[model samples]
Target chain A: MDPLEVEFLAEKETVKIIPNFSLDKIYLIGGDLGPFNPGLPVDVPVWLALNLKQRQKCRIVPPEWMEVEKLEEIPFSMGLTKLLLTHASDNIPKADEIRTLVKDIWDTRIAKLRLSADSFIREQEAHAKLDNLTLMEINTIRTFLLDSLNCMYKLRSNLQQGSSKGQFSNY
Target chain B: MSDALSDCGSDASHDGGQEDVMTPAELIEKLEEAWLNEKFSPELLSNRSEVVECVMEQLTHMEANLQRVKKGDAKASIHRMEIDRIRFVLSSYLRSRLQKIERFFPHVLEKEKSRGEGEPSLLSPEEFAFAKEYHANTETYLKAVALKRMPPNLQTVELLKAVPEPCLDSFVFLRVKEPQENILVEPETDDQREYVVDLEEGSQHLMRYRTISPLVSSGAVQLI
Candidate 1:
């Protein structure tokens, strides 16, 4: 069965959540989606059971505590991609193209982070330079990084999968 | 007064049923369920708030009756009296809550309407500040009040569009800033509209309104 589409309706905003296909119904209910309630904000700590349809499986990942990486050191490539895709700004004249380019840069950045430990260290040092900024502004910067990086990674992954078509490989 | 009450009990159900043993919270829960099922009658609200008092007293009476039964009073008449007492209490409370239930929807609707049309908001800036204050206060409050059940920022605001200049001369509104998210509106002589908006971004059903100002009436109850 296809994944059950879960829509979050809050105020006038609508957000559709897509969980990984392997997540189970029980896990979905017990995890973030089930624990999501209207009376409380998203950050509340509550144990709740979810009741997702049987088409998908779910798993619960505990909060990961890291000593080496402070909030500042964590990469923003994923969030940046989402923002570039969704957020529109009048100030950034070439926002779309710049976002695309930023995303490509991040893809290379992530590959460096994932494949070589030194790349991750270098990125952390770069982000640390923006320490004087407020948390919100820092988050925006990180989000920008995530958006570009993720897009590039996905493009690369797609190209690799489609490489079987010999004539189209160069393109 | 006690003798006058005993006669009312004699005329009601004579068996101690399952409802006789339920607590006040449980009874309200049952009434809530009844309201959902559309099984409630118009007579539900006829008794007013007395219904809640009566139900609470009835539950107390039944508990007393159970004690009597345990002490070796198994007489059929005694058991019947217990049942009758509970039934009357349940019916009375159910009716009262149900009666107010209708009033609740209208009151909320009226408040929303009045909020839309009523006075220019002098409270906008204060309200915004209060939201932030509430967030900070809630952070402290939640440490003591159990964060799992209570949110760190629970602010309710009554928002109205800026009033036009023509209406300002005749209207008077007072806005009092309180600690955290609480704002107190002074006793308003003219018509007043208050709306409670829940600012939690993740929640769907976050806004509600009521005409009877808790400050003017019985005071508002905060749920954490």
Candidate 2:
């Protein structure tokens, strides 16, 4: 993984911290940490926060997304769509609600991606008709279309299967 | 009802002999758990191929089972959807693995080359060949464009701009867990090696990665 991507993931994961003692600002190669003050809550990356919590230097506040109420409202919160799809937490209080919310979010994202992919593919096809589609453009569109179509098929199947399982279990 | 009960019975029985067979749902659940737990460490490189192959085999079985169900059956449709989901996850996992390998391709290749023996690569044969070709092309281009113009005395290239530098030499913020004494080796002097730094527990510092890599791996320190 790229260090940038690692940093991005860490940045996205917020953790609340309460420092135990006062400390001078510690400079790191990446950046400075803090002139940490005791008894004050501060938000930091999960990695840094977790380390502090482990050392008994700070108390950690979990991310808001992990809250059950927030998770339950996820399906309705179309504007709140910055959730990382890959960060699956096993110990969430409401597993079913979270699962459904994640599925809904995945479906929404995939739908948007498919829409863009379809237009791009169509444009590429039209360009190809005029022999104006460059090799790079063709390859890019091909991969995008393939991935979008694959995701679409998967989502469709999941939706169908979920409904069918409900009906089957009722019988 | 009997068929559903029979399927449940088979699933229950399979718990005792898990190596024999697994239901599609169980397989999917397993794959999802595995995907969730995957940390993309270097040690997991070999295991990833095996896991992918196992998932692919189960998917093939699931596909066959799906086909056997009557057309328009809801259960069958669900199975079809599950298969697609599994495929998507598998593909994404493979792609991420590929990206990691590609990012570290030059470093991996050099390590393998220095061993003086051909070893298995995390990438497929085609990808490996492509990386080799790409590196070769980049080196030739760099030589032609920049290196060739430089005076012969100053043309000594320390490292290729195209290849990624080793991350082990980079400084990182590390939190120490266990106290230990470490000898600090100054790069400039071979004679002045009396400097000893004491690593204190619960303290964090930005230090050379090589100085802390062993401690990190041994759980004596953690990278922040």
Candidate 3:
């Protein structure tokens, strides 16, 4: 299988189209497509829609997520993974602008998350000092702190190693 | 060969082809620029093959020049490494294009069939042939697997039933570009042909992805 196929399968997005011509039911290796009518809106795979658009047989409707206002309305709690999986489309004409917006949102949300997590852990630690913390609660916080610390350490070491390599490569 | 000599000698002539005679560093810079530009722009798809061909030609010339330099020279090794890096990028770039061709093989085949005989494929001939063979093999394998699993009584059933349908049930947001009436099948109301919603020129709404696809191709609203 081609790498792009794998990528598409992993991250599929549907495309909207308005056919300019009518057609009977067409069968494809993957599946069957519509008994299309001219001027009626139909949704199809992005690849198929692109092919039809290229042939001048259909008009493509831009996805709603492409709108800047809608994108801004996406809540921080949606998480980056969900946002990336659903919103990212190669066909988007303003992808760079969207990507920058996404990055900014992700950075802001992550900072907020980190702040909350830190305070929650600190509050738990304080409660534990007074013997108010449960064993399960202690374990959860312990795991979170360990994971975060390990990640930070790894990132720091990688940065240091990269700089050292750059300095020595000149020689 | 004489061709290779002429390819190299043309660089020294003061025609407008300064690129042909560029130094190793300059050549590497040019290659890097081309690669980055290709990476960033979707419009470069048609021109990619020629860009790659030019890079390969320059790389060949670079390798020939390196052969005359001392093996122990640091500059020679560095240039060789740069060539290797460029070569890797070129291969990956080609592979990405091939992937797109393969993914859209059915559409490509349909277009090709409609075109005149002896017309060129978007992909290189070798890649197109490979895609065709791969598709054929997959179909055969799927049929064989389906036959093996069928019950004796249903053995005569067509294999088409066993073929999985491409999943097309994802919802997407769409911005309405043109004002048009649509027959909406909302649960609250019966299928209504009356303009359910007046699609203002720049209004945005979350709708079934297929509903607005045609507008996108017609340069209605651009995907963000």
Candidate 4:
């Protein structure tokens, strides 16, 4: 999957936003969004929140996990951080600190991922428990890892057979 | 949109009406599941025409309602944005299926041909037509371009051998939705030992697609 597409899915994660203008409840296909009353907070998806924030119509209340001190304990999504920091940084307190902390966390997690993947390959393990790994992390290694695995399968299957033709299709 | 759901939603589920009474949110979720499954699976999966038609009906109804209201309304804008997002997913899901069909048309048609009479079809009627047309066009193109010049014995092409099948042995990341016991995990090579593992609900794993393909079809697990 494209990283942008992962970001698109991340945009669906709901966040709290305070709308400056009052409006009646709006029915949406996914679900109902807002009966926006001035100075009152309501839950809205990140996509709409960013749109409203960009238009100066709302202030986004950052999710609790985005804070610097609490960052280590909570599992953070890389796509969500990019979306929030790029568009709604002014509304979020300590945006720079959050960015640095999230990056550090990302680096540590990725280092662990690499080490595990190395062992997974070196050991020739056929199955792995992938709990707690986010879609973004899986996606980063997806193509290369899948291709190599497929190649290994093909190579192993070929050991018993004579010749295989036109196995890998053209991109 | 909610009011008009039962008015037309049931009509779309003519495949025995299994998903007859889904809410708009549930319908979107089903579509997303279908989308992700189609996106991750190595081969073409069973078509979710029921979900597709319902979403299409819902989008049309919502857009028709939008047309009646004046522009520049905040609610209207929000509704438009929501519609656009759903539409993006809907189109991307459909486009991925089409891409797979193009990549594996002959095998797709072969599967359709062999399907039992009362069983649910692998391809939707429109997709079936597309695969047939694609198969015929490719044969004609091959003959016209290169096959015609070859020796008569070598002219006939076996499409199954010509194109690669979807590699089911490829690894996939999935989250188990239902608990399964003693599912066999095949060895990578002859030297490695095979083992069985329990798939606990809500736990994620990486394994060969072939072992879990049935689970995927049954919606027992979701490919991430």
Docking class of 2: incorrect
lDDT of each: 0.29, 0.47, 0.46, 0.86
Worst 10 residues of 2 chain A by lDDT: A125-134
Which lDDT tens digits does candidate 3 get at residues A1-171? Answer: 233322333222466778888876643312345667899988765555655666677877666665556778854322222333344344355667766776676666556545755764443221111122222222233335434533443354456565311110000
Question: Against the true structure, candidate 1 has what lDDT?
Answer: 0.29
Candidate 1 lDDT tens digits, B45-131: 111222244444645664565665545432323334434534543564454443333333233223334654543321224333443
Q: Compose the digit string of candidate 4's lDDT tens values, residues A88-132.
A: 999889999888888788888888988888788778788999888
Model 4: per-residue Cα lDDT over B138-178, one tens digit each: 99999999999999999999998788877777788999998
Candidate 3 ranges with C-alpha deviation above 4 Å: A1-171, B1-47, B116-120, B147-224
Best by DockQ: 4
Q: What lDDT tens digits, residue by residue, belong to model 2 across residues A1-171? A: 233333433332455667787766643212235667888776654556544555566765445665556755543322112222223233235556666765665565556545655674443221111122222222234334444433443354466566311100000
User: Model 4: clashing residue pairs?
Assistant: none
Best by TM-score: 4
Q: How many clashes show up in model 1?
A: 26
Scored by lDDT, model 4 comes in at: 0.86
Runs off by more than 4 Å, candidate 1: A1-171, B6-47, B71-73, B76-224
Q: What TM value does the first chain of each candidate achieve?
A: 0.23, 0.42, 0.43, 0.92
